[model samples]
Target: MIKAYSISLGALLLGLVLSLVFGSDLAFQRQWQLISGVEPEQFIDFAYLYSLLPRMTMALMVGASLGLVGSLMQQLTQNPLLSPLTMGTSSGAWLALVMLNLWVPLDIADLSAAAAMIGAMFAMFLVIAIVGIRNLSGLPVVLAGMAVNIVLGAVATAIILLNEQFASNLFIWGAGDLEQNDWFWPLWLAPRLLPAILIFLLAPRVLSLLKLGQQGAAARGLNVVPMFLLLSVVGVWLVAASITAVGVISFVGLISPNIARRVGARTTSNELWLSCIIGALLLVFTDLLANALSEQIGDVVHSGIAAALVGAPILIVLCQRQLRAQDQLSLSLPQSRLRWRNRYYGLAAFIIALIALLSLLGQHNAGSWSLAIPDAFNWLLRWPRWLTAVSAGAALAVAGCVLQRLSF
Candidate 1:
């Protein structure tokens, strides 16, 4: 516990320093100089440092909250593959927001978050229902997540088709930008977080027993079903609150717990605390990078999309390696199962042709179902979306099939 606490403090301190050095203050030096009417601090300065507090506080709190939730979730589900993102809470929240704005004709601008929270809970319920029915394991969890993600994604696409403005904002938000427009952080997160932390801290004995297995925990007089439900609700809350604040930051939950495991933080208690620290550090650093580079690139670049671009690939590699390791333990599984195979090639081709035809067929106007294909780069910019979708869908399907075969 001491060691974990020390590590947490150390990481937080380091992240704080790094965040100060590289975040918005550094990125927008000209603006700061214009505002402060003085030379900017190289590493730390009192003038602009006060401004960093809110952003830093939001990042740390959200990161720690996500980390703890991730650890608790992994412990309860007994599946490292499971996280709030994969479980469909974030996507569900986005979908809920889309629905509220689309069908209800209500201005959810002030209250969009409430809609997201409710949606996240429902999404959590759906995931839990799917996984619970299958008796729970790595494969079931991953498959269920994939299914939920697909469904939610389609719903989001449908919503976007209806309202392009909402779609545009939703897309950026869906990619998970942590920038705050107001003091919404403390208002939304603080109330639930304190009590959740207390509950988790007090329930360590039960959590430890849970690591043995559900039946093992139950044998020890812990009510597995009720506890699972409670943890699921808390997990959903943490995820919803964070997403509400930051707009769907991906991989914090997965990466934090994995790093904790790698660092030999084997106990659930240690894992939980360590995961929080690591998660905080990871996000603060990522945000720093976002601020630094995106500022340089200007209007053409997007920080949220950039983080997803980098983080998604890293996650893919890590997950693949882990899957490979799992496959190795059961040597009888065919090596063919590990190979990359595309399943949606044919479907993707058809979709691409259809879109191309529509693009060609549609009249060039202000707005219509016909997408205005640029005359200059018609082949270049237009074809990639369909091709990319097909390629990704095919690859995922093949991977799933392989994993299922190996697991069987």
Candidate 2:
């Protein structure tokens, strides 16, 4: 535990320091002075004080909060396949913003944050309502979250398509950029996140009890229902505030706790704290990558995009064998006894290679599709997106296989 934390803390500090060093033209001495509250004499000084500092702070706060809540929920339900993202928070917040922009255009700017938080809370409760209090342990809660996400996402998309003009300003937020021109967002978000202290204070004991099984915990005189709801609402508040601060940065919350467990976070509190550190480390590096890649490629890659690009592959690598669980299913299907064949494997490989070849070389221009090698610039731009797509698709395919196999 000590070694794991020492390494994680060192890496996080290195990432933060590197981000500050490489992101600006100012010297480290001047940066230290700025941190010491010296008055700014140059634009870079002001940028360092305002833009860089607040952005990093936001990233850490949001990342830590997400990781904390994610671990909280996963431990609560004893289900590793859960996170705030999977609980419909993002979609709910998205739909609320869309509706606010449409129906309350005059107050949208002022009320957007509140609407998002409320929407997120509502979505969580809706999922709990679907699964019922007794059914929050496993796949039902996850499915409920998915159902809410699909419905809310579809509605939000439909509204945006119909009212594109009202939502014009939301395009950038939707992409999850963490660039801040001032400390206003950090200030706005900080107090709202104070409730996280409550989680830190209350959750470890409850979660430890929870690990003993619900019946056993009840035997120990823990009132599981009220404690569960209180903790859950607190978790939702933290997640919603993070989402409101940064638009829908997925994977940090989902992946951080999983990584923490892999790296020797044996205790509930240890997992929570380590995941928080890891989450912050991930977002800082991801944000740095987004900024650096944008400079290199002359395309603004948002933090969310960079996160997905990084997270999908890490998730598959870590959880490919771990995400599956044994569950009894009532439904049955006729089993097909098929023998594995080399020709089948060869044919599948051939099809995959053809698709990859086309994906790398195919271009649609002017009215028709043409097959040609991409130039260097296009290759740099396309490869990450393409590889991310492949990773995401493979992850989904694996999940589908798990679901199918788990059912019968």
The lDDT per prediction is: 0.70, 0.84
Worst 10 residues of 2 by lDDT: 322-331
Candidate 2 lDDT over residue span 1-408, tens digit each: 999999999999998999988889998998999999899998989998999999999888888888888899889988776788778887788788778878998996688778987898889888888878766665657668879988998898788778887676566776687989999999999999899889889889999999999999999999998999899888887877777777878778888898899899989999999988998988998999999999999989989889889876865564444434533331245468987788898999999999999999999999999999999999999899989999999999999889888846
The model with the greatest TM-score is 2
Error of 1 at 323 (Å): 3.1
Choose the strongest candidate by lDDT. Answer: 2
Per-residue C-alpha lDDT of model 1 across residues 201-278, encoded as one tens digit per residue: 655676788777777888889987787777777677777777776677777777788878887787777787788888
Displacement of the residue 398 alpha carbon in candidate 2, Å: 18
TM-score of 1: 0.72
TM-score of each: 0.72, 0.78
